[model samples]
Target chain A: QVRNELALANAQELINKINEKCFSKCITKPGNKLDSSEQTCVAKCMDRYMEAWNIVSRAYISRVQRESQGESL
Target chain B: KELGKFLESENARMRLQQSIHTFTDLCWDKCINKISNKIDRGEETCLTNCVERFLDTSLFIVKRLEETRKKL
Candidate 1:
């Protein structure tokens, strides 16, 4: 129950970051609708952003484990 | 370590929370050139190395600062 709420909050925060970053990177000019290119860019950007998050998560987790083990930084 | 047990430590939880934001922002700039459907191999490698060296630099600085402070 508590863990689920924490996960929800984390997901919300990630969504906010994706919107802010992708908006600037994808939406240069306002159009009547999201043009094909902009839509594609946003879709790709979302995936890449999540990938970036995962990469960091894995690296940091391992580093933390190493630190806890008294391994030299 | 168990995720639930790890979260029980406030210090560990908070440090992780802070580090994730720092690492994500730092690595995003270093690794991401333009958003693409998939992260290329080169970019993926850069992100991992970026995190490792970043922590290395941070530890180095802290050690340097402590030594200098002891001299004062």
Candidate 2:
């Protein structure tokens, strides 16, 4: 139960970030309604943002591994 | 007993995930310029390097603070 909540919270944070970044990139101006092109742009932006997040995670994890190894040796 | 171990690991994972969220928020702003069909190779490299450098900066600050404390 507690584990599930933690996972949910983590996912929620990711969703909030996606909303913030995708909105800023895709919506140049506030409009009454979201048009199709804006929707498309948001989709692409979200995908790229996720990719960027993965890249960052990989880089950080690898650096941590390297530093820990250096310290142990 | 088992539950305690599980919770400890969960907490550790949560902390790691939290840091990733912060790094992504900051580095995305620095590396991403325009929304395109795909993330280019240059942008990808920039994002990776951004994370590495941010951690380096963090370590540098801590080390500097410790040295200053020792001197004082």
Candidate 3:
């Protein structure tokens, strides 16, 4: 239970960092406090960042697998 | 040797992830030019290629440095 909670906290911290980055990228100006369009942009940016993260993760994994195979051969 | 091996593996893992984060930041700037509802195919491809090329660049530099060290 403690481990799970700690993991959750770490995950939340990462999410917060992601949110901060994506929000800054998507929202250029502090227009009248987050209009509907800005909110939508934030949502989409978050999704896109997650997708990029996954893509990068998979690409790195595959590259490692290839290199290890080459090393063994 | 065992302690060194453990530290080396941990260092490698951290470096790999750090390079990915750096690549993501660079490619995000290049590929993600606009704010959109979905990540288009172009952007996806760009991100993947960016990581691959970045790794290649790092490896190439490391190999060159090792060769230089051998000569010295």
Model 2 error, position A55 (Å): 0.5
Badly placed stretches (over 4 Å) of model 3 are A1-13, B1-20
Give the top-scoring candidate (TM-score).
2
Per-model C-alpha lDDT, please? 0.83, 0.92, 0.77
Task: Please state the CAPRI-style docking class of candidate 3.
Answer: acceptable
Candidate 3 lDDT, tens digit per residue, A1-73? 4446545654565486567777888678787788888878788887887778778889888998999999999
Q: TM-score of candidate 3 restricted to chain B?
A: 0.67
Residue B40, model 3, lDDT: 89
TM-score of candidate 3 relative to the true fold: 0.76
Real A-B contacts recovered, model 3: 0.62
Q: Name the candidate that leads on DockQ.
A: 2
State the lDDT of candidate 1 residue by residue for A1-73, as single tens digits.
5556666667777888888888888999978999999989999998898888998889989988889889653
After superposing candidate 2, which stretches have Cα over 4 Å from the reference?
none
Give residue A61's lDDT in candidate 2 (0 to 100): 88
Ranking by TM-score: 2, 1, 3
lDDT of 3 at B10: 64
Better of 1 and 3 by DockQ: 1
Model 2, B1-72: lDDT tens digits are: 999999999998899999999999999999999888788999999998999899889999999999999999
Q: Show pairs that collide, candidate 3.
A: none
